[model samples]
Target: MNSFFDGYVNSKTTLRLFVNQYENALRDKVEKENIAADFHSFKSIVPCINHYDIEKQFQSVYTNSKFQEFQKELTRKIYYYPTFIKKEGAIEVYQVTEDMRIGDKRKDVVYDILLNEEEFEVKCSCHHYEFRGILCRHVLCLLREKRIKEVPLKYILERWKKNVKRKHNFIRCTYSGMEDTSVAKRFDMLCNTFYEVAEVGSISDESCNALVEAIDKLKILFSTNLDNSAKDLHVQEGPSCDGKSKTILSLVAVRSRGRPPTLRKENKVDRKSREKMAREKKAKKKEKENNVKGHSMEIIKHNMNDASSAAGNLASQDEIAQTVLVNSSAHYNTFQTA
Candidate 1:
């Protein structure tokens, strides 16, 4: 002790004393306040998760229940931690000791999985702290043995969801005394959107269904079944119509009216006097409608004639077709005999 003190006589001695005193102070505060304690969920998961095989690849990795249980505890520690502990009201403690391998091995093998009795290193695929939201292949392998169809909702909601919120740095629980105006506005809008769409005391499934229903209703309400622009155009200039079908071909309608060739500016529409324009449009529309009705009547007459002709053809060819079929079948038989 004297030699140690003598070696750091001047500046070094002061620094050493300072570090030692700081460490002592921090240690005393922690011990006195009992600051180190796992959350409630930690205690609950420790017992429940104590003995679960996480690896079907090597189910023998954890030969004992103790190791499996320990592995679960380790999972909660790595994945749940602050969120799980905060939420799980039942658990008050979660504790585990280091593992001891049979023969001395490399550091990698030693701690690959040393949480409780759980053979984590061998069984656990997600060894790191993150990547716990969705079950890794290793956990799924274990769950399959236990016949768990899917990862538990408890793990997904309380454990995984909370972790995701923390990782992504989600919204503050309450925006108390927040200074960012833009953030506050956006948050408010989000809340408004949710409340507007979601009913009181609705479950997630119902809420999602309700949102879909609302979206469908909105779509229907905003849908355009008819073109209002056509109505407006009809009222505005009588009819800028040609006797032909309404098309790009009839845009030069006035030219076909035997008037001197007159070119309107690119964007301008030369009506050839509004009264004359109105007369042409009315006459053109009457002509077009008459033509359409005549065309429809002709189509109907043609269809009826076609059906009649087809019927006569079928009746006349029926006997001939049957004779041909009989002759072909007989020929096939003759070829087989030859």
Candidate 2:
């Protein structure tokens, strides 16, 4: 049993080490990929083919991949022409037709676009922004007709932004032994906030000293609160009723919910020990048998000596009787002669 437990513990340790190594390797791989992506996006520049101010804005803000997608829609805007339909309150509706050509077939697809000029918001029936998070050619065409210089800030998704720092990127990988807990997320958010503060604070010596002092005060305050809370938790006891403490006194050892384990297979050490015990037991039994036999022989010899002594006493008694009889007969014959 001890050996089995030892083996189980060793295997668990080995498995944990393997998992740690694998997680480290996976984290390194992801870091390399992210670095490579950043390098590629930074080094390579995609020229603005449409020469539109909006295309240039997208090229500067969006990553290379997302910029290419926007460029495709920008280039395809020539095929779409928007016609003003009607105005309803704040929204002006327009019908945009696309002159799409596939191989040898030509198809015209009409899409309805609602434009809010006041808010600079555009919604298209193609639902490109809704699905793929990119403005459709129809909406771009309508925006072009309206002479809008750039896309709205709301339409530009943070996920595809080149400069935006993603929160998930700060989160440790799933296999990196750090769970994606709310605390971790909050920590990342706080780190970003503090980083911005640090950047601003470092602009001047007074601001930097003030920031450091404030951070030290906050750290002390938080530490004190944590210690107090921990102390309170430690002093708190289990609930009691009617002045009686509800404390667990003892626990019974319950059998596990399974069939009892069979005898373990004997290893070389166990086998040798068992054989040694068996040999010692057999020798003890033989010694006990010899002692019993020796005791029996002594008892027989004692009984034989007592029987020989009784026989010798009986012979002496017979000789004394014969001598008394001979004397009696001699006395009778002398009396007769007188």
Instruction: Note the Cα lDDT for every prediction shown.
Output: 0.41, 0.74
Q: On residues 248-329, what C-alpha lDDT tens digit does candidate 1 reach at each position?
A: 1112223455667658653334545766789999999999999999999999999999999999999989989999999999
Residue pairs in candidate 2 whose N, alpha carbon or C atoms collide under 3 angstroms = none
Weakest ten-residue segment in model 1 by summed lDDT? 232-241
Q: How do the predictions measure up, each by TM-score?
A: 0.18, 0.46
Deviation from native of the Cα of residue 244 in model 2, angstroms: 57
